[model samples]
Each structure stands twice: as structure tokens, then as C-alpha cells.
Target: MTFDDPAVADELILPNFNYLGYLAQGSNVAENRINGAFARLLTPTLAFTIDSSWVHQNWPTGRTSGFDKTNIGLKYEAFRDSRHEALVSVALAWGVGHSGADAPDTIQPGIFFGRGFGDLPDSVSWLRPFAITGSVIDEVPIGSGGMALAPNATTGRFDTVLSPAVETLHWGFSMQYSSLYLTKRFDGGPPKDEPLNQFVPLVEFRFDSPRGQNTAATANPGFAYVAVTWQVAAEAIIPLNRAGGTGPGFRAQLLLFLDDLMPALFGKPLLSDRPAHSQIAW
Candidate 1:
């Protein structure tokens, strides 16, 4: 029982009266998510974006799950250099997904590259505040029980991600590592495979109000900056009897932001709604 013994695996923006949504419940399962996006700015570097998402999951043995995804995108900054204070950007994305037992029909394509470091100073600078990104995805698989679970499997997959970010005005940080490689084809012989890895970390804080009339157009306004975020992940599933080893799984997440919630929704600020939390192991 190795693959780390137990393992499991598993966005934002708005406008034009836009919307973003989240709901979560734990101790078995419950999840809901919604997202919408629209952007067009064909110059000043070029841009276009359209996005959509809906996800729902519920389990208590009585099983219930759902999935939906849609995306269209283009973004470009090509290159920028303000006397060696550099910046560059590129993006392309396409996605499609619809449920069957939580996703089977699929098509995805993505590419991204970014770098920016505007001179260094502000306190022990590491390339100003650091930035690096890389992404790739090509996945296509349709139905028939997902083609009978790896039957001549080569449904396509290749992934990579590395991110580093930091900021100061209060506090902000980011860290990420991802790897995916799945390629194997066997209908009569020779082709066996396994490789999947992921890790992520993040920290955040900010509160600024020097008058507050444009603190991002206030809707849940009246903030001077407050943020708390935590995440943990691990996965390893490579077992084809190579010493009978490797099978592991773990996940953790937590988030909190507070300024007001009607004094914890009416108990004089002792509120508990468990904001955006997640965990899984198998």
C-alpha cells in the first residue's frame, strides 16, 4: 500500500456586473464553484478572454457529482524593457469539459510564459518581487467509460508549472510546483507508466485605507486589509512493482478574511462559516 499509502488529486475574475462564487462544506463532502469572465483590449499589448465554470460535488455514499468547464483566451505583452527593468508575457488557452462521473469528455490546450523584475530595492529584493511561470496541457478523451480505463491509453497528457511571487504593502506570497506525465500504450505489449506530482504554498495579507473611495470600488468594502491563507498538497502514485513501492496522498487548505460579517452574522463576532476549505486522501 504505497503511492504514499493514501492519495487523492484535484481562478477568478469578473466584470460587466460580473460574478465569482464559492461554497464548501466538509466532513464527508460538499462543494460548489462558479466563475465568469470577460475581457477584450486589443491593444496596449493585445488581449481577449472568455471563461466559464460550474462544479458541484456531494458524497455521503449516496453519490452526486457534476462538472462543467469552458474557456477561450489570448493575451500578449510580447516584451517590455524600461531600461533593463524587464517584463514579458504570453498566453493561449482553450478548454472544454462536461460531466459523466465528474468529467470525461475533454479537450484542453494551454501555453504561458511570464517574467518580470523591475530593478531591485524595497527590502532584500530578489528580482524585485519575483515572477516565473510555465504551463502546458494537451488532453483529449471522450466516452465509452473513458475508453475502458487505459485501453491502449495515450489519451494525451503533459504538464508543468513553476511559480514564484511575492509582494509587500502589507504582505503577499506564492509558491507552486507541478508535474504530470502519462503516456503508455498497450494493446498487446510494451507500455507501462506512472508519474504525477504536485505541491503548492501561499500566504497573503493586505489592508489599506487612506480614505476609501476607490479601494477597489467597495462591495464587501470597509477593509484596511486582512488576509490569511494556507494550503498543503502531496501525491505520488508509481507502483508497478518496482520493489512494490510508492503510493501516497494528502491535501489541506484554509482561508480567512475578516473586517465585518455583521459581528459574525449576529453573535457579536465569533463567526464560523468555514470559508473555502478542502481536504482529501485516498
Candidate 2:
């Protein structure tokens, strides 16, 4: 559920719960997925997160569905400065290995960064709405149990199974234009309505490549409506190559800011029962 964006969750002081629905057409049947993410702030520069997904697979002759293993992670804002509208962060996560699920006790370490043009001169204030974010991660399997059935040399038959996993790379980047930031920080006149002022046109790229394996990627272009307590985003998924997918797809999501919806309760950092009296600037 994490989009590999540096400024994710930086706009508010609250925790978030997001639900996403996905759809894609395959060679024979349609594939669908349901994903969710729960993120909580631990401090001004730290956060905790949990993510999971369920998939519905379809084929010409058969169909199946199952839930993927849950992934738990933590993120630390390594550097930040609102004056420049920039931030840097690092994260680590473990995919809980489970039978009938996914992965093999996998670990992912990633770096993220985001920057905006808000600090530009007034003559180019319009460009201030533009921003960019990116992230890259290393995927590793803990144990050597990722095996596939292979032919046994001694027996001269397919009777052995050998580990098949290798180090993989997961990466993504995004370009966005935040209407909210443009008007709220740079404009002289009042802004538009609540959700309208929060529009952000975004394009995201996600890719993966395993050692000695083919590379695959997906590009998503869409707009998001961000609000104080919630957000909704929709994107059109396009394949970058043959390995990416067959054709265009789509994904829609709804996110709820628990902190804003119930600031007196869930909005505060997890380390403290109540919101901090003094804000920490980074």
C-alpha cells in the first residue's frame, strides 16, 4: 500500500487507514486485488506501518483466490526542511512468511526522497506546484527454502527441489503537482473549496527486477483529492514493457485519516497518549 513516496503522510499529524481496489485484464480472464494499509506516526520523524493484500486469480480453465502475507514496517525521516519543501527518509520491512501466502521471510530496505519548487522566485511561482518523489528497495529472502522442482541427476528423473530465489530490486518514483500547496503557500487570494483545493495530479512508476530475471514495470497516471480527514485517488495503469502486463488497468483507493477523524484519540503519536505540546521542526 505504501507508494514509495518521500512525503507520504507528511501533510498531517494523524494516522491513516487506506483501502484500495484493483482490476486488470489478463489473456483469458480478469484479475482483481484488494489491498490495505495502516500507518501510524510514532514521532515527528518516525512512523509505523502494516500492509496486506488479497488476490483473486482467474484463468481460462480455473480460478483461485487467497490473501497475501502481511508486511510490517517502520520509516524514519532522516532529513527534512519545510523551508525548501524537501524531505528524505528510510524504511525497513519484513514480510511475514506463511504457507498459502507469499514470500519467504523477506526483508525490504528502502530509501525515499521528495522535493518541491515552493522556494522558487515569484516569477516562476506557478512551477512551485510541481514536486517529485522516488524510492528504491532491496528485497531479500531470509532462508534458502525458495525452491522449485528439478530433475535429479542421480535418479535421472524430476525428483529434487532447489532454492530459486535471488536478490531482487523494487523501485518507484512519482511526479506530482499539488494544488493545495500552490495556493495555500504561494497565492495571494483565497483558495478553492476544501477538497477542490487539494487536487494533485500525479504520475507514479513502479518496477521490479530479480537477479538474473526479467525486469517488469507499471506506470500509473491519475489525480488525487486530498482532504484533512480523508483522500481518494484513481489511476490508470499502463505497462512499460511486455513483462509489466498486457494492457491498461486501473486502481482506486480511499484513505481515512484516523487522526483527523478522531484527533482526540487516534491522531496523536503512538509514543504518547496525547498530542505533543510543542512541535518538532526538522
Candidate 3:
């Protein structure tokens, strides 16, 4: 089945996040995922993130398999002026799988670059809030026990992703194209001999209150943002030359500042008089 099918497209989200989970089904396989991640702003210009996820799948024949993955990364803003800003980031990811699946666990390293357009008013800015990002990743096999089973499985893969995104006060959208080319070692050698390559497109909507300024000239904290996302994908597994079917997917999420959550979690009233930094969907 192709990942582009409505069934598959519904499983991915863009502008990504710190935590996520999903479930999907196709004619040939059923998949489930669970993930947790954290992102922290180190300075006005630097940020760091850590993420981990678990994925499990069941084939039509009743065969079940799964993998666990962890990733860490840092991002730095390279240039910022009144009209635009550019940033770069790099990440390292590790993976391990159970069952006899040759999904050979591996370490993948990648780097990404992004640029954003600024200089528009908040109310109408969503129309031109554009950003473009791209990344190249390398995967290297690891561990011993699993290797003995899929001895012919390829050692790893080299992949890349290109994504472009835009957002407004009430909506956001993005498209990502990812390609994975496996090496001709282990068992499957080369892109023509393996199941690889995918394309995904995502759309989202955010609901929030109006923006407000802070006193003493402090930075605007912005209002909380709540959003829902929908995605579609098309995937290919070579060698067999058989086209996989496609699927649809969806996600619902919310983001609030730590300060907002603190009072709510402690059963205190949300400060009623604070100047809103951004619109928030109540």
C-alpha cells in the first residue's frame, strides 16, 4: 500500500511536537506508535530536544514486530534580522527492534537547515509565515543478536527529507518528502532491492485568543495554542516492485506555557489580569 493513501496519510503530524502517539491500519499491516519528547529553549537563539518512540506492527499473516527509538538534538539560530531568521540543527538517533524482523537496529545522524520569513503583522502574518527545511540522514547497523537472523538484510540506509511550511493565526500547513536508499550489503543491497522511500503532506488548524502586550516592555509570552492535524502519505518498498496501498490519519493536540499549566495543576485560578502574549483557544 502507498503511504499516500488516505489511510497512511492520517498517521503523521507536522510542525512536529514533544509527545505523540498513533495507530494505523492497511490491507497488509496494522501499526501502533507511542512517543515522548522534550524541548527546551536554552537561550533566545538556541534550543535543545530529546525524543523517544516505540512502534509496533502486525502483518496480515498475524506476524507481529516492533522497534524502539531514541533521538537527541540541538538547534541554533544562525542569523536573525528584522525581516527574517535562519536556523540549523543536528540530531542523533538510535533504534532497536524485537522479533525476527531484519529491521536491523541502527544509529542515524542527521542535520537540517531552515529559514523563516518575518516582518508581517500578527493578524495577517499567517498568510506569509513561510519556512523551508531539509535534512540528510545516515543509518548504521548496531547490536549482535538480531543481526544473526537477517544476515542478508542491508546494513542500513541513507535518507533525506525536504519540507516547506506556512502558518496563520488560525491555520497551518506543510509538505514533506522523504527518501531512504538502502546500501547493497547484509541482504538487501541498493534502493531497487528494498522497501524504502515515502512522501507525506500535513495540514493543521490552531485556535487561540487575541494577542496582547506585556508591561515594562517584557517579551510577549503569547497565548496558548491548540491545534488539530491531518496527514496523508505514499510509500514504496522496492525489489518486489509491488505498490503498497495508501491511508489517512489525524491528530489533536494543545500547547500551553509552563506558567499556565503550573497554576492549573496546583488548582489555582489562572491569573485573570495578565496581558496576553498571544491568542489562546479557551
Candidate 4:
């Protein structure tokens, strides 16, 4: 449901698919993306994540596709307050460049946080089911940038060109309303096999601002069906500005919690005496 979460106990694997339609130079371009991520707890408050994606584009002139980039990162839970259902984490990630079809490598350092309103007074019990999660990552280029051959207007021939990569700020947040919280606090309990109580509806806002470039913003409205060991989610992407996109798009994701599904293998930290924990609210 969100690009990043503060919880370090989410030991899972997720695969997602996305579609985007945009206008480039007055021509409509469609992009399809397949992405996957794997996360595992190395300690009670530390985790490692690996992710990558492949993108295919259909343009007016032709079609092209390639693996975007690969990212590996470590997340450390810096703070947690169970009474307030709050969490915070610090993360550092490396984007592998030349190994893939993307651009220059990057060093991404980020902060992630999550907070639930359950601590609100009983007078506002209705808001107890709401939660907010956000993240801010700074992507700093590792080298000069990538190079490509482009036609030189003056020379009337192909010439080697340098594509300068600037630092980019990726930030986003998700607002969620969990029926699971409602059921647990007010309904006593939902009927068995009733999936409605396990649903979480959320709206996410994403913005990418690169130095010296117009910021791109997008809104994703979606819902997730969470179970004991797995989750399924879908969202519709809405461009919030001209720089975002020209048309709406969609995405779907499937996440599996290996810790819960295979406790013997994934239930404990790989190199810690502390026991593994689960942060799933439902």
C-alpha cells in the first residue's frame, strides 16, 4: 500500500505490476512495469531489503523495454512507542547502475515513519482506525552520469552526449482507514470468514522533485485485503499535474509474509538473540 514503512518486522516478499499512460512530445506512450521486493529481519530492529523492476514502453515510434535498476538497503528501527502505535526508522540504500539498464548509481538515505490514531481519546474513537505513514529519501548520484549517442544539430551526425543526473527527493505518504481496527475495538469481533473486516482503504500521495526540475506529483487511491499470511492490494494512479502524467493508470500487488507462513525458517532473526516480531496490525 505504501512504498516504504517504518516497521522492521515485515519479513515478506512482494510482487507488483503497474501501468502508466502518458503524453511525450504530443504522442501517447504507455508503460508497463513489473516489480518485486524481498525483505528479511536481521535483528529485532533491523532489516534488509532488495528490490528491482522491469519496464516496457510502447511509444509512437517503436517499443522498448529493460530492467530499470536494482536496489539493496538496510532499515533500522530508531524509535517505537507501542502505546501510541508510533514507529520511526532510518534507511540507507544503494542503487546499482551499470549492472542494469538504468542510469548512474545512487546513494539513497531515507527516513520512514508511521503513526496510528488509536491513542486518541474515546470521544474521537471513530478516528482510532486511521493511520499515517510517510517517507523521504534523497537520491544522490554516485558518478557524473550515463552517456548516450545523440544527433548533434550542428554537426548533423551522432555524437556522444552526457546525461547529467541530478539529486532527486522522493517523498510520499499514505493515509489508511483500517476496518480491522474498527472490528477489533468496536465490533467485539467480525464474523468468521467475513473478509470485509480485513480491508484497509488508503490514499497515497507521491512526489518526486529533482533539483532544478519541476516536481511530479501523483495520487494513488487503493484498498488492501490483508490476511494472516498474505495481502493483496490494488490502486488507481492519478496524475496531479502536467509533469506527473497525461492519463490515469493502475497497479496491483501481492505480498506474502514468509515469517508467518514458514515460521521455522523465517520467524527468527538471522543473527540476533532477540526474537522476531510481527508488526501487522490485522
Candidate 5:
């Protein structure tokens, strides 16, 4: 449910703060990122989303800070089989050109899916609490917008040049074990109200592969505590190779389930008459 969800929007917002400390060019560097997502359901199986972020980095010699490009998108649940706990979705996101950091405008088309094993037979009841979610997006640049610095021949200065932006394939998946499902659906050892029942332990793996570059990958191991109207989660970011990072880092988020927090306002779709409660499981 972290990369992206196949379920229709249950109106929500997530404010996230990420920190990264690593070695860059033999110098220690630290980066802080503030980002969030605002999503709202438009129909029983359709939703709108906006994602943005700002980042600040500290280096040994100086510092740099700026806003990353923003993304606006639409997601549609293409298929679902509640009986089997499977769901699939398609999405198209547009990155605003020059929105920030001079990032090139891009069109990202993606597929998202989720599957829960809750419908398994009694023999595998233990695996019933497990779930998997994943996403695959292709980033296609609209035009050349890459920026680079070049030495000036006439003057002892540097000139900024624009180059072709690289296309990338972004993909990731998360494997989760929901204690909440265990307590609610089966006669488990722990009571429904047990503190551990609120936790969803998960591990997320992410990869970014450029058209002509080596792929960068990382694994994030974490857990999320689910509540009636809110959730809190954290993860340890572990680089899988040199292309990913030089050291470990971590990220955390606070998610607000607006539909649960204020049902009167978000209990129904803005463009449809379907009840908001019709949303599929995450």
C-alpha cells in the first residue's frame, strides 16, 4: 500500500519527513525532505492525487535547498475480485514542467496492484494475514530539460547547458503481515484490542532503472500502525548497491484517513453517488 494502492481512494493525506545521511565524494552529507500526498476519490473506482516535496541538503563546503517537481495524477481500479482479495489499477501522472528544481516535464503511466491472502483455506490460515502491493511506472520526458555546467572557452566561467533527460523505469513492491487482520478474521492468540494487533510489519523494495544506466535499488524495512482515523509508519532505507546510496537512512510518515476522520465531508465521492465506504481494502 505504500508505493501506490490499487484500491479506490478513501480520501486521505499523508505528510512525510525523510532524512538521509551518507558519504558523497568522500564528504559527509545530510539531506532532509518534506513531502506529502493529497488524494480524493472521484468515483467508486477512480481517484485524483497530487504529490509534492521540498528538499534541503547540507554538505561540507556549502548547502543546497529546493523544491522537487510536483506530480498530478489519476488512478483507476481496472479490476478487482474481493473474494480472492486481488485488485489491479492503472494510473497516469503528469509532472509539471519547471515546477521546481528545473525538472523536465514527464508523463508517467503505471500499473498498481494488491493482493491479500485472507481468503486462503484453513490450512494456511496463518498466511491469511499476509498481503502484497506493487507498482511499475515508466517516466517519459516531454522534451530535453537536463541541466549541466560547462566550462566557458572565452571566459574563466561556467555555463549552464541543457541536455536530453533520461527516461526511467520506476518499480517497487511491499510485503506486509497485518496483525489487525489476524485478530479480526481468525481466533488468534491475541485479543482484538491487543496493542500488537495494530501493527502491519512490512518490507518494501524499490528500483530505478534509467534507459542507458545501471539500475539503482534499495530495500526499506518498516512497520505501520493502523488506527481508526490515522496511521504512523517508519522505515530503514538500505541500499542494495553502490548506485543506490553510500549508507543507510530512514523515513517516516503520518497518514490521515480523512474519510474516517470526517465522514460527513468525505464520506461520498465528489463526482459520484457511491458511498465512500465502498472503497476496496488497501
Candidate 6:
């Protein structure tokens, strides 16, 4: 499950060594898959990501399937402000074409932004715990092209080449209510017995609009429990329309902070030996 942090534009997540994996079975696609991803910081403001998946699928024609191509991306923090808990970033992702990597090759460029509501007034302090994060991406095909048209029904003769594939735009929006904000920035302290104080409840919406194709969208509601070294989350995936899916799906994640586990390695650049100045804070 995913909840975009309101301060997501801040890219503060870069400091953590995070790994999340999920298993999914789809009603509309007739497939079962396992997907996993990891993100690591390469520098103070740069990060790299690796994502892979295994899929078992059955097409309408009774065809079987296997693993998908691996995916990788690099992101850079373009702007940040610790005082505001805000950040802006840009990233480029690619589907690596290799054996067992059976998905179409593509390149996606994405931009992200997020901000918290810690600057609100006392009258509306309740809403001050809320924050929002958003992203926009453009999907561009790289190598899946030069396709032939269907053969004539009667003569079975090959036709002309198929038209070039169209591009698509994807967007995501997430709203989060941070318990950390409630206790730290709010006027009153939290109830000592409050079990959910560290849990951030959030909802996310994702949309895909393809040129010359039906659009797809999904809404996900979930909660994330933030901790000193890790976090866990689960959400219900609700399709927005038939194009999105026939029914709901599900998502879950276990994210780890590498710096917490291996401070010397994950806390600094792997390519460097110099001592860095990053440290944890309460």
C-alpha cells in the first residue's frame, strides 16, 4: 500500500533504505504476480531504485505467461526545505529488456511534489496534521514498434505495418494525516494510551490517460505505521471504472530503513570513503 507523504516533495525518504514487496491476483487481467522494489540514496539528494516482478498469467486465448522485465530508475531532489517539510524531485524510469523480461520497453519521466500543512492556524489546527503528495509522469515507448497488421480474414494475406503506439500520461495524488504532526506540532500532546499515534492514515488515487485508448484509474485507502527502523502498510485498491478493473485488488508493503540497519554502508555513498555528516534525529 502507498500513501504519498505531504512532504514527499521533500524527498526525505531518500535517507532510508527501503524495500517493499507485494503479491497480487487480478480479477480483470486473470493473473497472479509478485512484485518487489527497493530504493537507496546515492548522494545527499539523489537516489536509485530497482523493481522486479514475477507473473503467472492466462490470456483469453489460453496462453501462459512468466516474469516481466526488470525496472530501474534514478531520482534527484531538485528542491527541498527542512523547515517546511517540503521537497520537489524528478525521475526517469526504464524497463530493462532482457531474457525473462517480457514486457514492452519504455521510458517514463516523472516529477513529484509534496507539502505539509504544518503552517496552518490554531483555529484549524486539526487539519494541520494533513499533508499531500503528487506526481505526474509521461510514458514513452522505446522499442515496441514496427508491428504488422492483422492478416486478411479470407485470403490470410499480411497487411501494412501497424500505426505507432501512442503515449500515455499517469498521475498520482495522496493525502495523509500524520500522527507525528499531531503530537509534535499540535497545541496539545497526544493521549498516552493512543496506539495509533505513530500511524499515518492516508488515501491515494492513481490515473492513467492513454492517447487513443481508454483511461484507467484506481483509488487506494490505507494506513502506514512509521517507526524508528521500518514501516508497514496495507490498502484496498478500488477501480474507478471498467477500464480500471472489474473489481477491487489489494496492496501491502514492508519498508525498511537501511541506514538504521547498516549505518556505515547505507548511511553514505558506496563509492566514497569520506565520513559523511548525516545522522538520525528524534
TM-score of each: 0.24, 0.79, 0.40, 0.89, 0.88, 0.75
Better of 4 and 5 by TM-score: 4
List per-candidate RMSD values in Å. Answer: 24.6, 6.2, 20.2, 3.4, 3.8, 6.7
- Candidate 6, 80-142: lDDT as tens digits: 764565767788889675535433577888888888777678898887778888888898877
Model 2 CA deviation exceeding 4 Å by range:
8-29, 99-102, 146-163, 181-195, 273-282
List the candidate numbers ranked by lDDT, top first. 4, 5, 2, 6, 3, 1
CA RMSD (A), model 5:
3.8
What is the Cα-based lDDT of residue 221 in candidate 4?
98
Candidate 1 Cα outliers beyond 4 Å, as residue runs? 1-29, 32-56, 59-61, 82-115, 121-282
lDDT of each: 0.29, 0.67, 0.32, 0.80, 0.78, 0.61
lDDT of 5 by residue, 1-282 (tens): 337767666645456887878632233568888888888889877889889889887755556678888999998889988778889999999999878767689999999988988789999887888899999999999987767444455764556677678899999999988776655544433355566536888999998888987788889999898777788899998878877778888889988878878888888878988775443343
Which ranges of candidate 5 are over 4 A from the true structure? 23-28, 148-163, 184-192, 277-282
Name the better of 1 and 3 by lDDT. 3
lDDT of 1 by residue, 1-282 (tens): 000100000112321121112111112333444444543334434456665645454433332333345656565555555444334445554554332223344444333333334345556443333433333333343442221111111433222222112111111112221121112332221223422221222221112111222111111111011121212222222222212122311222221211222224321212233231111100
By TM-score rank, best first, the candidates go: 4, 5, 2, 6, 3, 1
Error of 6 at 67 (Å): 1.7
Which one wins on TM-score?
4
How many clashing residue pairs, candidate 3?
36
Instruction: Assess the local accuracy of residue 99 in candidate 5 as a C-alpha lDDT between 0 and 100.
Output: 83
